[model samples]
Target: MENATTLQLDPEANSNQTIDSQEKILTGDRATGSLHLGHFVGSLQQRVQLQYRYAQTILVADMQGLTDNGHNPQKISANILNVVADYLAVGIDPLKTTICLQSAIPALAELTMYYANLVSIARLERNPTVKNEIKSKSFGRSIPAGFLTYPISQAADITAFKATLVPVGEDQLPMLEQTNEIVRRLNHIAQQDILVECKPLLSKVSRLPSVDGKSKMSKSMGNTIMLSASEKEISKAIKAMYTDSSHLRVSDKGQVEGNVVFTYLDAFHQDQDYVANLKEQYTAGGLGDGSIKKILDECLQELLKPIRQSREKFIADPSQLIAILKEGTERSNDESNDVLAQVKKAFGLNLF
Candidate 1:
């Protein structure tokens, strides 16, 4: 079996791997914040494995952040490379994965403009994904045009590369449906197949809870373990972690349910017996939160030590990291342009 590092994406090549229905998978996250342990468990873990199994395109969604956070270009800019750092640290082998910046490509925006007219304005309002995001961001009354049309842009992102699989959590199934809607409409209107239908691959774990036991871990909540955090920083974050609410003392039996510590163990630690033993001790009493935290510290350190080291190395020579990003964006543009050309031809908007 060949390593993912040996695979390559050459846009100019004639004899490359087949671009079959199973060739590509596209997915990614926003770079508006630091990545956390939840990111590792829920998404990055799958990305590392899929690199070998499929042609993956990981888009750093910097442009999407601007829809609501338009005033904070600096915020998105600051975290762009940091997110790339996280991706590289998590072992997203650059050779197999096209780690692209969404904002760097104009072709995608063009595709979005073309598809936007194909769908009704009323249909855009009914898109479940866009509606949820609008509500979540409290944009009910004053939604940005870009915010309302994000699904169109997403369709552009996926169809521009002819992505076949988009790994999204269950909550994001609507976005996949919207993208397929555009694909169906575009093909039907053109009387030719200009795009491919994409299937959803929800995360195995779906989402991870925050250290504060929040249903979702987010950097905004400050209950996250930053991937680049040092050992002392990781320790500090773990010490501040929320524990069982009922167990006020070491002598009291602790409830494992809704306990962030145990949940962390479940998500990060695969040693079921060890976790079970710890849970039993915790449930019966005499197992202090400190003890459990110490166990978590050790486990997380083992997981993060290598990644932290890699991050430090990448951070030391950011120019080289930027070079990789530039190369990736350039390669992605070539592919995007090729697909865009086909789409324009389908619409009879191009000649010669």
Candidate 2:
């Protein structure tokens, strides 16, 4: 068995590495809402590039979406297909990358039930990601147990496929850390490597800030540009984006440090030199926020045009989307059930 250590992969350097066709990657999104530009920059784009090189599976985690929204179960159910559409729109080929619905996979829930025993409430509370989420959600004394233990659920999602690589953002590193802890503990109890430890394939791009610039781009906050955003919506979002508050006029010097427009340009604009030149002009007191916003608007409009069209086409044919999910979920069921059997045997629960 390999040493239990986390290996980080720089997405920029991924092309230079030798292709490992056998490597299995498991990455996905919560089925709470449609994906956005932040999703593209953070992980969806990487998934598109990786599917051709590795055996990848994207899990639409509806069960995880229920952690906090359990009171509103309809929200999760309504968006499962929307999330899958966004994945397809963003170029994650369903044939190359298996796209599975989480609720459909019974083994995952079974695995989560078993793995929950390996993790403790104190350790779950101490997790940095969970801590931040709890504070931000203001759950107060009403924290949901499912919400707190979703990391263990996440571990089940990863290990059931024996996924060796998981694409994640920096904020999610703690979740992976806790996953490895569970993997190691279970293996230790089994006295062998029945479950394989996974590594984090961190995104090279930083998390995109919300248009309001007060927080990270999030769907629940209504501060993000969705993948299926129309051209008019894109332009409107760029116009309202937070930029230098002090630059009241075109001739006034602008600060680019916290400007959301420049940040989007840096992430989306293909020409870095052009963005740098624009930044220089803005800081030197000549460029206007409108001019730069126009540039960003144009860039995003072109970028999202095809994605919007693709998403719309998929949405028009619900049967196709259902077929894709059904096929992928069936495949996932077989694989995850095999892993659950091994885990059950490890726990001496395979009495039958």
Candidate 3:
């Protein structure tokens, strides 16, 4: 809720540099797996629009993916390109948005080390996001230190890019809050605003539920519809989506609230008036689950057709993906290293 304007940059220290007046955006996803429809409605769609309006940078956070998957590094390594492909498939232009790899940017790791000192273990343990993840992952007694401290790493990611806006869900507000805390602390220590505070740009659309309708859409849960799902796969997932169990007959009045079929229709079906009519008919006891499922199947197939095609093209040429990532990372490295220099200068680490 606090404004980023309160944090001031020391003019004398940054006098030679022409400050970028454009609002810089930093957002990303871990490379644990391919992105899903939940991503499409939630953040990916927003990122596509943001690229055209602002200075946007998408970080493929391969390093952060290792936090909980330290035992299975291959999963993270394998999906890095797949994730980038999904971005391109969804309309994120590499020419407009700089897409970089996290591990490729050494300054992020270095910044994480410096930012970690500003936060305490007790403070990290208290973060709501960290606590919930620990419980969900069932890390009970043997939590990975990296898993516990990745929030600090995230703070490093945001600050290193001097990001002014970060797209996040409501649940992720805490992470942005923590990022600002570190930025404020580092500036206090330096007696100058070497780091810029960032604010959360909350998504307007609600998160899409998994097909089961009982859980959040997640690849790890195998309950999500992937952006790159084949036609048959999408159809199969829609067929299995949870609907009002009590609506046993086409004439039986259905409950639209918890029906996953209706949920997907609301998100994917472009014609709201048509979807609304369907919902009304279904709720009034004249509609069947199969009818809505059929409609949803059509909608999803149409939505994903082009995305899947684009993703396949990018996936086929791994070198092109690599080249785009390399160029973005190189550009990002220059920007982040400059910020890192200022941070180190504040810490009096620039002995040379």
Candidate 4:
């Protein structure tokens, strides 16, 4: 909707358009911890589907992680490989999707510094995601400047790769808005159409609520089932899942609304008929939460078994894992440095 470029549409043309071969997509997760089921449903699954259709670049955003976890470099460092393993385990083919480390790309940091001036502190303060995170972390008056400005960094990341598509949840809409604002401003100022605008590929299953039936799934809240969670852990988490609190007995009428187990089944299970029947039986006053939980546990265990196995195999080879990251990082540098050089030349900073 926010436009720096215009599209010339033919009045008689067909509505459907073919995807461009050169179109690129960029997506990533902060390397603060291992990914969980929420990540799978929200973005990773979409990435797998998009890999062959577009040139995809997946970043392990360690620099962004430092915005919040600056005090714990060890945690960020350890989780880098874990996140990459999660990507591979979930069928992200490295040959098709370039997986890179954010810290290894110096061009991104430089771009961030330049782009920061294009955005105002007042605008950053108004960002809903940043505001929500500040409240969640209770940063009241001690909010880190880096955390507040990470949106600029994110804008830089997207434009550095000239990404045309970004997979994100509904809550991240504000962030994409900010990114496009900067993109349009930069291209206008340079008067040369330098940067590209990106569209958000909103996930169908945008979010999965917390296991305890809270508003969202979060690792910090201890309500997430890790992508590589053991069968035992999956069993325990599913068994402890929140259900209708009023249904105290097996014969008591249960409410399907706001039930966590059914929510998960709706997301993960392909057998819609069975899930529908389960919901119908659940509300009919004779079904028990334990029986529903057992079904969910088995479904989850079977779903995650291969993912856990693949993760373990990747983790066993530290050198090979590092090599993959290093290669991807090098490729990122080549791509981003070209963009950075163009940006510097546009600003008259490349006066050599």
RMSD of each: 5.9, 2.8, 6.0, 4.8
In candidate 3, stretches whose alpha carbon ends up further than 4 angstroms from where it belongs are 2-21
lDDT of 2 by residue, 1-352 (tens): 1333233334464445555776789998889888999888888887878876788999999999999999999999999999989989988888888999999999999999999998889999999999999999998669998998999999999999999888876788888888889899989988999898888776667778999999868777778899988888888888889999999999999999999999999999989999999999999998998899999998999999999999999999999999999999999999999999999999999988
Runs of candidate 2 with Cα error greater than 4 angstroms are: 1-19
| Model 1 Cα shift for residue 19 (angstroms) | 11
lDDT of 1 by residue, 208-261 (tens): 677777646777777888888789988988898888878999999999988888
| Candidate closest to the true structure, highest lDDT | 3
- Estimate TM-scores for all models: 0.91, 0.94, 0.94, 0.93
- Cα lDDT for residue 132, candidate 1: 84
Model 3: per-residue lDDT, tens digit, 166-258? Answer: 888778888989999999999998899989888887666878989998887888787999999999999999989999989999999999998
Query: Which residue pairs in candidate 1 have backbone atoms (N, alpha carbon, C) closer than 3 angstroms, thus clashing?
Result: none
Candidate 4: tens digits of C-alpha lDDT, residues 1-352: 3422222222233214343576789999999899999998877777776775678899999999999888988889989999999999998988878999999999999999989988999999999999999999899769888999999999999999999878776678789899999999888778887899898866556378889987567777788899989988899889879999898998998998899999999988868799999999989989999999988988899899999999999999978889988999999999999989988877779977
Q: Which residue runs does candidate 1 get wrong by more than 4 Å?
A: 1-21
Q: What TM-score number comes out for model 4? A: 0.93
Better of 1 and 2 by TM-score: 2
**Candidate 2: pairs in clash:** none
Model 2 scores what on Cα lDDT? Answer: 0.89
Candidate 3 all-Cα RMSD: 6.0
What's model 3's overall lDDT? 0.90
Clashing pairs in 4: none
Decide which is better by lDDT, 1 or 3. 3
Better of 1 and 2 by lDDT: 2
